[model samples]
Target: MDVSVFEVIGPIMIGPSSSHTAGAAKLARIAKDIVNASFNRVTFGLHGSFAMTYKGHGTDRALVAGVLGLYEDDEAIADSFELAKQQGLEYEFYEINLENVHENTVKITFLLEDGSNYYVIGSSIGGGQIIITNMNGFQTEFTAQYSTIMMKHYDRYGIVSEVSAILANSHINIATMRLNRNARGEEAFCIIDTDDIVPYDVKECIEQLDGVIQVQVINVND
Candidate 1:
């Protein structure tokens, strides 16, 4: 039997624990990407394995650096908090129980400029694979391994189906998806995971779609 791609490379990463460290970083990065304004403050809640060993395993630092837009392979991960401070970002950390969630999971809440706020819950499944379990109180999930992910811009008269249709036309197969909208419904975002590797051409095509203001590729080596 042919091994699924996820099965082959899902457990290895440059960290003490693939789920706690790498997963935490990916989750923080996703949250950073979705916020429209500059992030001024961040709060992280750790659960399971993340809560148990985040400090020792460098999970906390990894997460902090990721939210600050640093890549997984960045050498500065160890000094993420200091770096964030230098960049005028502030953060706090805490431990919480998620009630029946994975051991290596965390919740992050961010306060951005203009008084906007966002929250995210995510888990690191061993290897380098991570799943975003929730965003802004919405039950959703996404894999960050995709080469291209379309993040919908918040606006009135937005139709999510149109975004899906555009991907279908491009012959892209969506592996997973997660959506979040503000309580007022004035702001919204969708994180899409696709099977097709994203190239510049494909990214440009998606950016042209209505309501899509940005197409970002989050990867370790990008």
Candidate 2:
């Protein structure tokens, strides 16, 4: 028997552990990307190893800096909390038992300007990989490896079907999919996982959709 490349190689990520370091960073970065307000405050619910050895391993600061849109390799990670304060981002930290969830896991909630808020539950899988288990109130997952991933804001119309049509026409296969929305239901994040890497032109096409706000490629290599 043989394993698929993705199964063996997993994702290309910056790392200490896919589950502890890189995944944590990616989760933070995505949380920042989805929120509509400037991040004024944040809370982290750390569990297991994340609580036990976060500081020694740089997990704590990595997550905080990530939510600030900093990458895993950024040298400022160890000092991100202070940087956050200097940048007007106030944050709190808490320790919790996630109740049989993955050991290296976190539940992050943010308070943004304009009185809006968002929360994300995610796990760091191992090599530098992460899976977003929930966002806001919606249960969802995304592997940041896709050359191109399409995340659309919520719309009442047939958005999924329409987007599917475009991908199908281009001969792309949907590898995995997850959907999430904020508590207010005013917005949603539709994450499309695909077998084929996203081509530059295809990204441009998705960005042109009526309800789409931003179409970005998570450069896994970077």
TM-score, candidate number 1: 0.73
Task: Encode model 1's per-residue lDDT on 73-98: one tens digit a residue.
Answer: 56677788899889888888899989
Clashes of each: 4, 7
Model 1 misplaced stretches (Cα beyond 4 Å): 1-14, 147-161, 171-191, 197-222
* Candidate 1 residue pairs in backbone clash: 10-127, 11-127, 12-127, 49-103
Per-residue error (Å), model 1, residue 118: 0.3
Instruction: Write candidate 2's Cα lDDT for 85-166 as tens digits.
Output: 8888888778988775678888898887778877878878766666667767666666566644747575547777777888
lDDT of 1 at 56: 93
Off by over 4 Å in 2: 1-18, 147-158, 169-173, 179-189, 195-222
Q: State every prediction's TM-score relative to the real structure.
A: 0.73, 0.73
